[model samples]
Target chain A: MVQKYTSMAYASADDLVFGKAKFPVKAGLGLEIGAGYTTPEINYAPRPQAGKSKEKLIKEYERITTDSMQRMVQIGAPSVVLETEHVEQMTNNPSWGGEVAHAQKTIMEEYHDEYGIKCALRHTPGDIREDRDFLKLRGDKYDLLMESFEQIAQNGADLLSIESMGGKEVFDYSILRNDTAGILFGIGVLGSMDMEMIWSDIADIAKKNNVVAAGDTDCAQANTAMFIAGGLLDKNLAHTIAIVARAISAGRSLCAYEAGATGPGKDCGYENTIIKSISGVPIAQEGKSSTCAHSDVMGNLVMQACDLWSNESVEYHGEFGGTSVQCWGESLAYDCSLMNVALKTGKEKGLRDLFTLSDKYRDPQGYVLAYENAYRVGQAIVKDGTDNYLRTKNAAVECCTILDEGIASGKLRLTRFETKALAKVQADLAALPDNSDQFMSDCLTKYKEEVAVFRPENYGL
Target chain B: MLDLKKEDIDGILIRYNVSLEKEMTPDEAAEELYPKDELIYPIAKAIYEGEEDDVIDGLKAAIDAGKNPIALINDALMVGMGVVSQLYDEGIIFLPNVMMSADAMLDGIEYCKDQTDEVPEPKGTVVCHVAEGDVHDIGKNIVAALLRANGFDVVDLGRDCPVDEVIEAVEKEKPILVTGTALMTTTMYAFKEVNDKLLEKGIKVPFACGGGAVNQDFVSQYELGVYGEEAADAPKIAEFILASGDGIEKLREEFHKH
Candidate 1:
């Protein structure tokens, strides 16, 4: 019972970075934004106008979402995510939350009607119970979500994302019962106990169905994501590691993005640099406060590294255990490449996390080449014959070491030119120092300046 | 360090173990199950881990030991809870652990009081709740637990609580601080309603509001509206108002901006 994965991903993954060419929208890629009119913070607005029927409030929410989706389509976004709250969850309506589901479906219809793009309706039930409590759904009121989902699919939902935050019970049920064109797990914040198990389960399902695993990479801010971010837990590193591990083993692509700074700016890494707290991770600390942006910068780099290594690790097709490709740690070379791009070339592309920030794999081989070229010179210092770093504990050194186990079989799919380029970068990074902060900071400063333009006014929903 | 096993310790929750971060390690799990203090460890262990039965049984035993009521209060129980506060801050512990720990701490204190005929006055009373339109209270629940652990008597007005109910609790309780949490945008306005009603009644209670959807800009718009950024800020806010006596304006100046 070996795991199968996608091995026939394009020869040049860089070309697929911004997502596959949009016949109308990016195929197999989409961003899930909590739609509805919200205040400066992304909470449900119109709370002031109370006693409005569920229908009326939903209509207002749909109107606001329709506007946002049109803007998204204009920007060449491949997929749109529209989520609906339970009638009981939203207002005190007992009419099965059907209208609420249909309201989301209508937004999808309107988006398709206008831009003809596919939309994923994330049916959000209030009871986001985990495996422990989710099983209590036998006769629970949330069964209405299943009913509403049927109608939405019939009306033309391109994708039915079981919005089970960290809950898999509902996800399993949705995929089994629904006849939607596509099934995905709306894992905004994976607060589950066994994340690797969840990814494995998702991979198992993708073996048979067209499935995607999406998550919010904002790291900290709200209910679940906040604990990871504000606590300064080292779980961020675990997340990237798990994604690549799963990418090689699971037959699904991992999609991760941010929820934006819609809450306290300092808490969510909005405008502030880093705010120190007792909960901060020790390794990610600067003086006292956790360097929030630095952790994120590292997070972005690790994920892109995952894509590169996973892209070449296992020769998985949609078929299960097609070819047992050992991951020869080719991704390590890519990571070294990125470090060179950041430190030597002084480029911002070197720092982007492909899962959350970009759709493209920015010049990974180029960065590796730059790193290798520098290591040959005294551009990077090496301490102890073993401790090679661009700087002390350079972020890339830890990141690449994280993927040292995966050994892909067969000669890597790199072209002769690509192969020479990668070899050159690997050579340059051979004796680098672990001083990542210097290289990481330069890239982060540039990244922050670039990302400031895309901050959403609101965040939590 | 005690030789007691997990099952012997009683009250540690193995399930409900997932947080945004990693799972609790076996060391943390062991520390939680077995109280460090060997003497009244049962009480602390019961409270810290998850056992009401152990708490009750241990309290009776301490009373039977004829332990000095006051000495027991200051040394054994407080020391255990001090560890709890630190573990909580480190995100190494859970609320149920703290809640049961506080209960054990209180039961020991109460047993000592009954024996010595001593009745200690509570440090202060605090009223907490989620806003009228929001039903999410896990954050509020955490705040109340921390406040209780820190020695304040918290009157929790449950989530989806109406403005009148919160104001009623505040008026009746005459608390030092009244806090409301909301994770929805629509319900944030309810914080303003509570503020206006409190103002109308000439009750000048400090109203703290925060949660997922609450913004400093939004909460600051209402009177007596001081924004609490996280649940961890709850006990700190209580200590601030009680210690400084600087009122709401001073709090706003320190913790929030327009």
Candidate 2:
């Protein structure tokens, strides 16, 4: 059975320092994440043409893996995480994913034995159930997803992670309308149920294989909001709504840790900051450095308390300076080096402040993600921790309150439209009944009719 | 225009993080926020502020003043949205501001349509959808809205629409163009499946695919695929399709950066 976090591992926000965690998990080669120093987690994908043949795919993986580790060795990276996000082709063909994982792990082992460079392979299989009706979460594709996870763990992967897509159907609908209650029902309740179901099995797989079930990310929910809010492409979704959705996602992602995932959660989960504060586990964060994969407003600020600094993901190709992995590896390694230097000089807090203040006021998303605000959201989550619905609702309320205060105090800048949105979101959240059962039932009756794809039965309502 | 004192205007500038020139006046700052024409200012400001009721009031006043409703849409409503888009591009404004402004502009357009007895012909028809199995549709939604704003009739196929549904929509709607967005690598392959099915059926509607996981290379590999680098590019692509007579290579040549 999973034990839900009811209290914070750190006494206060001040105690939540970078490169240190109250709960650290040791993985391959006796390397410890979230124990003493931050490490670079490098993620890359094979070129598109590799999908044409299994041989080409494996060969591409081998090239990128060896190339990245060699650069890590040259950079003298203390420890590195290589996240292999299995493409859809691999999930459909489970054996292909296993072979790729085995090959990459073998490369990691060879590098470690040769140069004393510690590394871990985080095998992230695609959530194949999303290919169809993810609501059912049981079918040939679902079976393949689970089997792929087990296969990778047994094939020398040190950590396991998946950007699971549970409750995304409803999240997509609710976020478009900026419906806070609907979002709560979708991510808070439906997403938690899916996380518990999947992570319970994944936790067992990790235990059986003696590997760490790292964590899950709210990529489908929160990251979608972040992407929409960051660029000028989509203007319908509010940054205020995105920030609140991120806080709500904390409850959903927390289910993974509750179900036995240890430390160093996935990199793309901007919600990992709050999860780190709540669960006190090592977290992998991607920020300004992640521009190779995507852009965001909080690149500098996200580094405030990360244990594993990542470049999100870069394609396996060459750049002007070097291959994508080599170039991004140096970028990530240098960032880690700065933090390590700060830790050595006992100036970690000073460096953390610079990171936090630089991007805090640039966007509401960044303001809420600042470590101080994340801790507040964390406190709100744990205050109602036992109840998934209530915890997420509390987190959203805290985020809104934080933004409201920031705007009122003239610390956070927002346009007139954004200010109006913040008010509307706060009012909408306030309108929801404080009772979780009432909120869930009301959302069920409402969203069932409003959202065509939403079914309460999928969430075990 | 915006009947605000200097303090209120300064407060607006501060809230939006807009720096004024050393000696710029509050009037100039207001003009910077929206157009400064007597007839267009109120409507533009209403749209910029996303005030739907005010937009309606401004449109009613413009109509009473014997202004052409369609001209108001082109000059005032679209112009106001243009300002909002520019502010967003400059990072002075954000998504919520754009959404509200879009809502206000659309409302103004609807009001203008109500005032006119003759139906305004749309430039063309387009069908937009998020790729199958991918529920991230904000990009699709924005593209659809922009297309509608540019006077195109958009048949919106909402998020996670299956491949069959897309093909069915195309066959039924007979749209001039179709677009697909996918934010995940796993789901992006569904775009290829969609294009292939369209090819098998001999439906040669120009297909524009984009999103985080999609690139020009992936789209170029398939026939009838035009990569959209931004949501703003959708309407331009639709215009290009209408003008160029559905040539995929030309459409790609004009739009795809890489």
What total of clashing residue pairs does each candidate reach? 44, 2
Worst window of 10 by summed lDDT in candidate 1 chain B: B9-18
Q: Which stretches of candidate 2 lie over 4 Å from their true place?
A: A131-134, A138-140, A231-236, B1-123, B127-138, B141-174, B184-205, B216-225, B243-258
DockQ of each candidate relative to the true complex: 0.07, 0.14
Best by DockQ: 2
What is each candidate's fraction of native interface contacts (fnat)?
A: 0.09, 0.12
Q: Estimate each model's TM-score.
A: 0.49, 0.81
- What tens digits encode model 1's per-residue C-alpha lDDT throughout A1-461? 22211122222223221111111111122322211100010112233343245656666556545543554465444343433433234423324344555565666666677776645543323433212112222233334434444443343232333322332322222122220100112121121212233333333332233432222111211113223222223211122222211111111111110111110111122101110010010001010011211222222322321211111111111223111111111222233234334434533233422222221112221122121211211111122112211211222232232222111211112222223322332343453323433433443343234322211111111
Indicate the DockQ of the complex predicted as candidate 1: 0.07
Task: Give the Cα RMSD of candidate 1.
Answer: 19.5
Q: Write the residue-wise lDDT of candidate 1 on B1-258 in tens digits.
A: 012232431232111112243455524644754545556776665555545567657667776787666666655556567667666666565443565567567776676677676666677888988776555555786678778778788998777788899888988989999889976666677788889999999998888887765778777788788898867677888888888973888898877844
